[model samples]
Target chain A: MPKASAKKSAKPVEELSYEEALTELEGLVASLEDEQNPLEDSMRLFERGQALVAHCSALLESAQLKVQKLSGESLIPFEEESE
Target chain B: MQPTLFSSIHLTVSQLTLHIRKQLENDPTLQDVWVEGEISNLSRPASGHVYFTLKDKNASLRCMMWKPDAARLRVNLQDGMAIEAHGRITVYEPQGTYQLAVNLIQPKGEGALYQEFLRLKAMLESEGLFAPERKRPIHQLPNKIGIVTSQTGAALRDMLNTLRRRLPLAQVILAPSPVQGVEAPPALVKGIQLLNYQLPDVIIIARGGGSIEDLWAFNDERVVRAVAESKAPVICGVGHETDFTLCDFAADLRAPTPTAAAELATPITILDLSSDLLSARTRLTSLTLNLLAEQKAVISSFISRLKYISPERRIQSAYQHLDELSRRAFSALTHGIQIQISNVNGISKRLLSLNPEGILSRGYAIITRKDDHMVVSKVSQAFGKMKVRVSDGEFEVNRGLDTAAVIE
Candidate 1:
């Protein structure tokens, strides 16, 4: 009964901070690059890595916007002026 | 008193300078004097010294704020921050003029100037100039880079060399302009607008380090506005690490120096890109190999199972089944034959039992005349010329001489 209850109540892992997620993603990348882990473990890591990547991407997107606002400008293509 | 002319002359250079300094220090009018004027020709030297001219409508006096006093002032000293300085007027013999040696300086309240900066900032911000959503992302690998700096300065050269070294494929377009003085602001603004029209992937606004006065053009409202309004992502690399300008804030990115700007603008080398591609290819190949290995393992397992089942045993089982079928077939055939034979024997026995001859052998016979096979039983028939078959043998029948004829 205890085992069944544990299985029924199991929740997904908590969301990580941007730095944590990025670190995890880097670790996943390194592990994948090494190619030494078992297939099942690798698949698990890949799933986690996908989540981390999404988190990092969101963080970067927001950070870029904040920087742009602070800088008070639109960062766009350069245009030239005529003499 | 008339006899000693040297004594009458009386004062050495140091003594005269000290006397003047002490007198000015004690003078009540010169001390704590409030002078309202336009500031001009402000100079901050390497030795942490400040020299500027404070002028009224008619005349101007040279003022000096040594490093310690200037450093103590809270507000930034600009060419036009109308300020009141508490100082004494003293004569320097070499200059032959009495100047203000300032001890304390404070702003006269930057009401109009500060308000203008705020107003412009708010106007641009309300127009979505400062909106994060409007800012464009810098390209990871820009094919073309535009630089807005003086053509003669080290800034342009640094950026060019960096681009060449890091990203050889990148084409650099130099939008040369003056980087200092009054002309710099207009030139920079025009350069930015021009670059916007040209539409380069990325632009760098850069300048070497200088005094605040020298770098003032970058702080101009026009230059800041232009930078903020640029269509291209502008990177401001104006001066050393310690220096900052309005352009830096308005720019999409800021680098510590021209070299750092180059580094930020283009960091990836072709070698790195190729190495990344190669690594990706290797990863794909490894994944494929692993998948193939798993498939091979499954196939080998199936083969082993097939081998373990034993083909010879399967054939032997088939042979045993065939033998069992043959035995059943033979037994069925024998049983059918026996049934048929028994049926035939029963029919023959019934036929033998039914036969009249068989009855005769049982001590019974059908009596008949010798000439015919008809059965006769009455004596009258026996009197007529009848031959009869008895159980023992055949007999001929004879008519008796009638006593009845003698009697008639």
Candidate 2:
């Protein structure tokens, strides 16, 4: 758990991995949320945030619910009628 | 062959005893009774009837139970020992004496079955089957979920409904078993073993509330051992919230009810998570637009500096075009993530009217009187030849003298 931060510190927000996107996006959100920075800087960060979010969403969409149970063999889908 | 009753004013002893016996049999309250007391003066007659006096400190009652009822006695009864007896009260005909016709008897304190339950509990608990440190945390994103329970039980239905409502996408498969009676313990053990072979991310063993005997299967030593040894984390949702069993202790997690267990096992749906991404996308687009407007303001202010410095015009042009291209790309990306937003493009188009030059791009003209150089908002304000500004350049429009006055 402690190593998570050590690894994250080595990485930049723009080049974040899929698991780190949510945290980076949330941090960017908090930073930009006040509208304090000049428009150009905020805009640059916002585009980066968008790219990161899109990558994270793609990962989520790829996962599907996989169902299996013990039959005579180890684990098989429940829809198998012969069981 | 003894007696005939021929009485003018009174009944004989036998006739009176018969009347008492009939009264005792007719009373409904005495028909089926459960009495708790110490037994005394016990005797077994050759006829297979067991006779005993059931006595508390102050009172004693004669009890006689037939052989068939006596044969079913789960615990042996002896004189001067406390027992709970079930029987009906009846009066003997010849003696006119009332006695309890005993049907069932068990030791008064914690019957044999309950005693066995306590013994198993103590043994398992001493073996550290219930240690909290041994519990495994349930997996956060397990796709496959297994449940070991009777398929026909209400617990199964509740679990299914909860899983469907909270996260219909989570996969749940059942290993069916009987959750009650003497034969239930082994069935439950078999189900758990089968489920373990599959190694689901998590397993839930569930049953509805019942008496101690009904829940005995969950407390069975074999079932408890299986839960403790399984590679997958186990959740025991046996009986109601108040009900507790050894399985609950041995399993990795204990839930108050089956539905609560289901909710814990599944995570939120993908759609719910994607909505967050949608919101982030919106913020990104709006930020880009805000930056563009800010930079426009900054450049207009720097226009005065152009008199002192000759800026490199060629490089400046290329940079401006690159910024514009990036803006267009950002807008396209915004549209791709448009599932959560409706008519966002229309809003952006409306924002164009906020800038004076942008409205001209839509083929609208701004007219001003050349003499006063004041802008005209209404069409009626059009007087003599007016300077009308369209998108590209300026032009003069000639108006008739009565054009402004003709209406009024």
Candidate 3:
């Protein structure tokens, strides 16, 4: 059911890492492949899958690893090692 | 009676000490006894023999551990360290003092702790907390990965570098807590809760290589329960490859080292998922195109093969056949008319000989009255003036007698 995807909207697909995006994209691909599926839902999943593929590829091509630490409630940049 | 006074009455101090030493050495109970006391005045000389005073609050005994026996000491002995020494009690010959000739030494309270560790392990193990079925499989690829370890510890550095090199796309959140000491247990539990609330796909609780006491925090009940309660799969890497703790049992996966935890957390790297995504995309694209081509071919064949033979072509063919037939008909009629024309011209010569116009052209005469304007068939029909008519010329003669003269 597309309702399964309701939680995915909270975290933007673009913010997801390559693995996250790729996992979601794979699910979407499987859903889209079902010919008997509703066209409207299929189209939405197709669009998201396309975006995920692009996002995953872009992240793979980029060369940076981001690290953050939880402070109070928010994430702060952790750079303790550089000092 | 002769040797009586010196021999029978008393002996020298050396003989008395020698008899006492032999008596103590012959006693099975005093041969080897375990003496537990605080060590005081410990002395390890160049000869490598260890000499120490084993004392309780009441009294003290001189203890001597031989060089080879002291070399077997697993636990270091200091002046204040409480120890349990095992050896025989024998009197030294010159000083004639009875002391413990120590052969083995161990820490006083460590065995009890080890027993407690074993007891707890057995208790928890019976409850199925350490059952293999309870362990969740590690997520194949984790996006949000939480790390619980000391911030300044080398384990944290190692995990960070490993994650960076292997899979940069994984987002890491550090939950820093003391990984050692008495305070580490509750702190580590809190760290686990915090990461669990962060909704990470997976978590790694790890520490570098450590002694049993240093890593005892991992065996803490609270830490083990926290690991067991996690919704996300957890990887426990508490010590070196040879070391394992109760946390390793409660964890979903046990990694031998912190770097191994990192490796297990990031099962698929960016490069790996990238290639997989590309492959999926290629398959989807090809599949779509194939279906489209299939439909297009059906449509094309239907339109070309089936609809092609419909009325339009039929009318064109009909028109072509009609034109050909009409052209043949017109040519055949013209040919028949030309043949008839030649046949009539050949027959016309015979009919021409019988005609009077041809005979008159040779020579012929006829007379007619002028008033009637008709050719005279007989001379009697001539009026007062008769005209003679011939093929080439006409003459007038008087009455009927002029026929013959008119001709001359």
Candidate 4:
């Protein structure tokens, strides 16, 4: 049934770390390569792997240094010295 | 005792010195003594041994520290520095002199601090705070990093620059604190606590190289305990490679410099991570495509296999066999009818050949006496009126007339 994979893909892709996304993508590749899964399950895994690859690429493209200070309870912007 | 015969058999210098060496080496009070004195005539020879004389106003003692022990000394030795030395007293038999083989030494002013450091180290070690199993592995890719250092110090800048250059994806949370001074210990402890509240993946506590007193805050009991108890793994980079503090021992990992800590905090750089992501995507694509190809092949093979055993084909074959059987039956029925017709024709021909009517039509006749209806084969037997049979008629006077004509 489609119910098993529904829970797996429910988690938002934006919330995953780059490492997490890469790990999941690698796992999907391994399972798909195993050739034991049914056609329906293999398709589901491929879809998930595609999403993870996209998420990882997006994370790589969106690289900006974020330095902040812990002031009281909040994290304020950190002013870095000019090189 | 006879005083004239050289009293006690004049002892050799080597033999006397050996006796003195044994006496001094065996003395419980002299061995393992901690002597306090001002260092004098300190000379580090080419052999790496420190040959120094320690003297007070009353007397002086010759001290020799081996290369290994001398290397372990944290303080730079100089003449006229008041120090406390610990070692066993032993005699130099060649020179017939006694000296202390010093293994441990501490400057007089800093000696008490060193004693306290040792005591805390031993206590924390017993508590398993510095256990290898207690050390947590640093995250390969830290999303959020917490740093505790002086904002004005070069260490913070170095670490920031290194992190920004290597991996800018990580968000750094700086908890500025005085790294050294009387106010530093409590501030450092508070800074670590504050970072722990944020729950960053990793924490870096660092400062530039300095004297022991200058970096004493890291050695403070409160700071070391804070590091040991940190929720997130702590990386201490408080001083240069040679300089160490108690916090370094308590931290999950030790780095020689602040920059090194920043580097260590992110083991995988952005470039490597990006390449890895691309490779994984490629593998995922290729693997899925290969699976699809295999599935397609399986489906096609299934279709071909189904064609061989399909019921529709079997039904068609059954229809062909039924048609062949009907054709054979029809041919058999026609052949049997032909044979029956031939038999009937043969029987009718035989009956026709034996018919007496055919002989009558061919001008042959049969006669019999009228009295008993007997057949007359000879002419004398047919004198009277007799019956005669012909092919088309029957007559009574015909035989008599025929016979008379024959007689005439």
- State TM-scores per candidate: 0.44, 0.46, 0.62, 0.61
| Residue-pair clash count for candidate 2 | 0
Give all candidates' CA lDDT scores: 0.69, 0.77, 0.81, 0.87
| DockQ per candidate, 2 decimals | 0.02, 0.25, 0.39, 0.59
Tens-place lDDT per residue, model 2, B314-407, is 6788899999999999999988778436567677677776889988989888998888887878767778878999999999977866977886
* DockQ, Cα level, model 3: 0.39
Candidate topping DockQ: 4
- Regions of model 4 farther than 4 Å from truth: A1-20, A23-48, A61-65, A77-83, B1-23, B44-49, B57-59, B62-73, B87-103, B109-111, B121-140, B151-168, B207-215, B235-279, B302-408
- What is residue B303's positional error in candidate 2, in angstroms? 6.3
lDDT digits (tens) for residues B118-201 of candidate 4: 998899889888899989999988999999999989999999889988898899999999988999999899989999999999
Question: Number of clashing pairs, model 1?
Answer: 19
Position B387, candidate 2: lDDT? 94
Worst 10 residues of 3 chain B by lDDT: B399-408
Candidate 1, residues A22-71: lDDT per residue as tens digits?
44445455656655665665666556555555554554344311100001
Worst 10 residues of 1 chain B by lDDT: B399-408
Candidate 3: stretches off by over 4 Å: A1-24, A36-51, A72-74, B1-112, B348-408
What lDDT does candidate 3 reach at residue B18?
A: 91
Residues A1-83, model 3: lDDT tens digits: 65576245557877885556766766666655655444455556656666777777777778467788878667898886764
For residues B148-254, could you state the per-residue lDDT of candidate 1 as single tens digits?
88877767667666776676656666677899977889988888877666577888899998755667787787898898888889888998998777677777888
Model 3: docking quality category: acceptable
Sorted into a CAPRI-style docking class, model 2 comes out as: acceptable
Candidate 1: lDDT over CA atoms?
Answer: 0.69
- CA shift at B343, candidate 3, in angstroms? 2.0
